[model samples]
Target: MSEFSELRYLCGSLVAVLLASILLTRGWRSKHRHLPGPPPKFLVGNLKDLPTGGHEWDQYAKMSELYGSDVLYMTALGTGLLVINSFEAAHDLLDKRGSVYSDRPRLVMIKELMKWDWNLILMSYGKNFTTYRRVVQQEFQPSTVAELYRPIMATEVIALLDRLLRSPEDLIQHFRLMAGAIIMMVTYGHKVDSVDDKYVALAEAVREYSAQRPGTELVDVFPILKYLPSWFPGAGFQKYAAIGKKLSIQMRSAPFKMIKDRLASGTASPSLASRLLHQSVDTGGIDQDQFAQNTCAVVYSAGADTTLAAMINFILAMTLYPEVQERAQRELDDVVGRDRLPNFSDKGRLPYVSNVVKETLRWKAVAPLGVPHATVSDDVYRDGYVPKGTTVIANISAMLHDPSVYSDPDTFSPDRFSPTDQKSEGEPDPARAAFGFGRRICPGRFFAEDSLWLAVASLLHVFAITNPDGRGGNGVKGIRWSSGLVSLPSPFPYKLEPRFSKAPELVSAAERT
Candidate 1:
């Protein structure tokens, strides 16, 4: 045989061998696929079932209703997906077997260029993650968080009230400013003076880039797309990375510089970043890149947006159910009084108000699918095999609205969380699941909860938020939601009138405090 023909024959044999190896691996996996799931199409798998844009979770809800809790499948790109649609299932996997299910799936765009592998929200479960989590835990200890941040939170809440009083029509911007100011103060020890401040602008820019879009980056689904060169036009991943780099620099360097300047001048306020920087200088255990990048990523992405989304939902809930709002306001009035704005100290006394916050989180979890978790080892769940490296999603939306756990899961009733209601019944309160379960749960949860509680209590006490009468006006009548990974109440017209006639006196009192 000619040399060319011999080479062709050899290539064909190698290709066939590679194909056989792949088939053998898949066949092995198929044997243990005991979980009931829709049959996958050849090559595409169950990609067709995955929804895009705002409808993703909505579609997942419908599927859960049809297929039951444990829905397992292989995506078009050969990625294993397990969507846990029940609280019990999520608890069993994310909490009970956290060791094998705590890591995040490989995010090519975030991992490669952005160097986000060490971010607490994205990092895999390991010693490095443990170290970072430890630092965060120390920074956000309940006592320290309340003590160090109560004054700042109070100031921001007052400012939010002021903004609302001046222009009661712009509730969306008011909510954004309130959330952004608190997060900014917590992260940088600097207050956001106005919604248009430089820091607010930066936060909004970061949110815009991180907002998920339909088929935004093919790389998220097709891992091989990361292999494409940056020069390739129409490669959305490259643009995303570039945007992330710009955001990373602005987010990291700006705060680090602030800390450095403050330390040089010996005028730094006590903050998580300041403390971490000081500790880094002494121990030299944490890498500078990891420290800066991870800190900024936390504050910028997870800190601001998640808190803002929750706050927005709280406002939306109040607007939808005015009776709930009135009860919360009455609770605040009895405990906090109009003489002073609500503070963290009033938390225990204001149980009903706290219940409202919990209900808001459950009603619309900020990130419906609580950040996709990756399997670190092969997981055996009720005779079904979840192969190592499979992408597992804790469908937080479904879990929050689980019919078995929560009665009338679709309703927006805060009574389910009232202390007496749970004690009266022999059942555990539903608010326990709102913060999430297990190792990967949000670390800033305490901070977020406090911010929302103070803001909600203060807002309810000071102003009456109502759906704007649009009979002859342009105000939004029926509220709608915006589409994104973080589902926030879409911008709607709402009137924010002072509850009492003595508005000026209330403003004066707030200013005095």
Candidate 2:
């Protein structure tokens, strides 16, 4: 038989075996069987109910609404999946009971097949994970970001503005280069001027492959499939996994080796990698070199894609809300003035610009479903209970878009956050749910926000971004949102026009300094 035919035969045989085994074990029961969710099928469980297209976060939110509970439970192929769809439930569970929910699910595709075990974000909760968090947190705290990384952030924004002005059509590429540049510089003291840079390509490739999750892939739900030989019928995942493993290793080791070589020659530029390497110590049964390498790789991969996605969403929002853009520009012109670009010193004075940044994060969360958290022990909440090892997901997009939390939640209104005479408290900050919750929150959040603030402020100050096809200020009609670990608007045509007569001069001057 042909390879394709053989593959089909193998898949059919596997399913038959699975069905027979399931029938034999039908006597088994689930402790979470009473939890709120759609009923499972005889063999597929909730497999057919899982989202195949569109945003998973949105589907999960609808499920939460249909069940009339913020916490949801479902099973696919006998694996338990728990989704926390509201901020309150997420806080009550993932935050208040973090000791039980901080661990990550055994992402078979991400860890076993792709060999991304070094990823601190997906690593199980333990001493190694704690140390990795501490290492990254030390470098990205607000004070440290302000004191040390603001210059790098500002420099990148200026470069981005220059690129946007020259080739406005490649808006997404410019954002990618800008985000990659800032991350490469901060994490490894390496410079990236183009999206085609080898390091940038490597990071992007790894991010794309790593998007696979447990429920999405049969191999992830049944990890024993990982042992299948690459030449085996229906084992294409094994071959794909090999590519991911190669990229993962290169992503972690290449730039790190350069830094180490430079350090040996006493020529290493000060960077997170070099700094951590200098302070490397074998402690808690962890190898310091491996620890630093893993930390730096995770920082680079995580920071680059997320910032790029957020920037794209910011541009999409501007294209769809010209009035909001105009208002932000007015604030920028009034505060920072058109004579020059924005700087960290003016951040406090630019309240409206700050709110615009906050609205961008809330309007479209980059990671719609924040990294999945796993339960290490059985947990009870309200009338339901989550068994140990349940793959817990916080629907971050739902929380940020909760209508009760923010009136007219779909509207992109920066003023929602501004305190008024009648409502002095204003709306709750989306940052609480935007960055994440509990111990698994993004450590680089402060740095990410700082970079985003400068980029948004500078872009608004220099250019008028609008849709080229005259879809200005219209709702997202032609635009489609991508669904993945990080979600953002797909590429759409947008025009960039200089707001000030001296826009080019301003970008040039900023670059010179």
lDDT of each: 0.70, 0.84
lDDT of 1 by residue, 113-228 (tens): 65666567878778877777776766777787788877788888888888778887777777778777877777767767887787678768766766543233556644455665
Best by lDDT: 2
| Quality of model 1 by C-alpha lDDT | 0.70
lDDT of 2 at 374: 91
Ten-residue region with minimum lDDT total, candidate 2: 26-35
Candidate 2 root-mean-square deviation in Å: 2.2
Model 1 error, position 234 (Å) = 3.7
Error of 2 at 296 (Å): 0.7
Q: Model 1 Cα displacement at 235 (Å)?
A: 2.9
Segments of candidate 2 deviating more than 4 angstroms: 1-33, 208-215, 280-283, 471-473
